[model samples]
Target: MPTGAAQRPSVSSPRKRRGRAGLVLLGLASLLAIRIWVMEPAVVDSDSMEPTLHPGSLVFVFKAAPQLSGIHPGDVVVFQSPQDNSMMIKRVVAVGNQTVEVRDAVLYVDGFAPDEPFVDHESIDGTHFSLRRIPPGEVFVMGDNRERSIDSRDFGTLPLSSLQGLVLGAGR
Candidate 1:
């Protein structure tokens, strides 16, 4: 009995709008869950990792896995500082069972030079140092700004348990 104009669909009603809003809320909740249970946010506060990560850079760290095989060399990670319990970021230069040495400011792992293009500064002292067979469950970490960092060279190797997470990269 209604004309074509009268039969036309009306604007979305309040009920329909509520349903759409609910879906949006659900999506946001899912994202929040993932962030809380998996990745965590970290803020850089020093130039220790300069040329790679600078002060004020925001990054996300993936929580350490329960069954991690081992931390590999070249992986940027966050850990508790040995000198102090404060969290610090550094790159793994040597893993357990591997040897690390710095000779005349050049880094050598197991007698071979690593391709460390990220290092932007020479060691402050430019001296020689070595660690033979870093004990199991430990890693040697160093800062890209070697000249200004207090790392394995200063505090020695850190226990794997000290590591909190692996830095994936910068965030937007």
Candidate 2:
């Protein structure tokens, strides 16, 4: 009967390693595709969205937002700044030919106060200098922490061309 040598199978060790490597490659490829085409993760940078999004927290954004729902007031959004390529994340207060005014420490949308319960108590009117109607195809954004945010009050309304996407959800 055949002994030690004959008992050894003819499988090559290197081929087994290659098969595992191929599986790993396939997994990495799928992850990359999902990141680029499906979703993107972002880290909150400041307290601008306090009571909602906290600094250093991770959040996911719908990359197809601009192409899908566009943008609307009350939606938390993420966009590239027109003044700078840096990213800017804020809440959509008013969009497209709507007037956004902060007066007597109240936020009025299209001439009516919105149900913004997320605003902090210390926030006495928007420090971003009161403003009038936002231009067509433009959006007025502001941070939840109205006390310390420079949004439309500083650069005026944001052009739709400057938006990146809307944040769908956030992680603690």
Candidate 3:
């Protein structure tokens, strides 16, 4: 026979612990979903995009369809390497329906010089690159640091399907 005070419920510590564990599990699940389905974070490992994106800087990509937000020239993007599935990041130099040619130390697209403020410090001299006619459904990409970048000039046009996403601005 117990009094009303003695019959009061006693809270178990295990219940609190289980509640915390459930919260942690839910947070981890959300993060996994974001990483696998939404976007991915990346770090640049080389100077290929120097002045635009430097080594060790963090970046992000959409990893969705290219037409989700159509690839535009001058937008920086990341893609699967043609040689390997490894990732590569570069600027979109020319999209489909454009021709790119290097002559007299300048880049000419469709025989007109694009006013590229980003290419000012690059060296296009004596590179001996052949003119390129960007094919449909493919894009020509290159690093802003043209002199040191391994890009379309060396690897040829990359298909739009190969692109991961446009670099979604920069990362903190």
Candidate 4:
């Protein structure tokens, strides 16, 4: 009868390695599928969403966020910039049929101010701005760092269709 060293089986077999490799590839493929069809992870690229989303912070985006619950004010979203066609992340300040205005460093939605705790206090510099009503099928977005962000204030309201998705949460 085989015993001790003579009976011991090789742990480093090619078959076992191939099985492990196949499992790893399967796991990677599953993750790729989820990212493509379910959620996508993104890195914050600018201070535009400071206080809320810092630069380099990782965030997960819902590819079908609007489908879950239609876009609304205060929802952080990613969209294509009309100015340069680059992707930008900002908070939805006003939706279609709403009025947005800046006066004395204060933001007013409709006719009243909405509590915005995520905005950078020192970044607001709304000295004087006219009231602009968001047209249908569009939204008014603003960066948390209002003063430095070139958003709707610089370009104008964005088409709702341009939005890619909403920032669901931070991390993977």
What lDDT would candidate 1 get against the real structure? 0.81
lDDT for 87 in candidate 1 is 88
lDDT tens digits, residue span 1-172, model 3: 6556656587769989899999999999999998886688999988888777889999887766376768888888888777777788998879898999876657777888777676654465655556778999999988877788888888899988888787888311
Better of 2 and 3 by TM-score: 3
lDDT of 3 at 53: 88
In terms of TM-score, how similar is model 1 to the real structure?
0.77
- In order, the Cα lDDT scores of the candidates are 0.81, 0.79, 0.80, 0.84
Q: Estimate, for each residue in 24-63, the C-alpha lDDT of model 2 and write its tens digit.
A: 9999999998788667899988888887888998989887
Give one clash count per candidate, in the order shown. 0, 0, 0, 1
- Candidate 3 C-alpha error for residue 18, in Å: 7.0
Model 4, span 62-137: residue lDDT tens: 8787766789998888888898888899889999999999888788999898898766556565455699999998
Which residue window of length 10 is worst by lDDT in model 3? Answer: 120-129
lDDT of 1 by residue, 121-156 (tens): 344567578646789888998888887778998999
| Cα misplacement distance, residue 113 of candidate 2 (Å) | 0.5
Highest TM-score scorer: 3
Clashing pairs in 1: none
Query: How far off is model 2, as Cα RMSD?
Result: 3.5
List TM-score per model, in order. 0.77, 0.79, 0.80, 0.79
Poorest stretch of ten by lDDT in candidate 2 = 121-130
Report the Cα RMSD per candidate. Answer: 3.8, 3.5, 3.9, 3.6
lDDT: the better of candidates 3 and 4? 4
The best candidate in terms of lDDT = 4
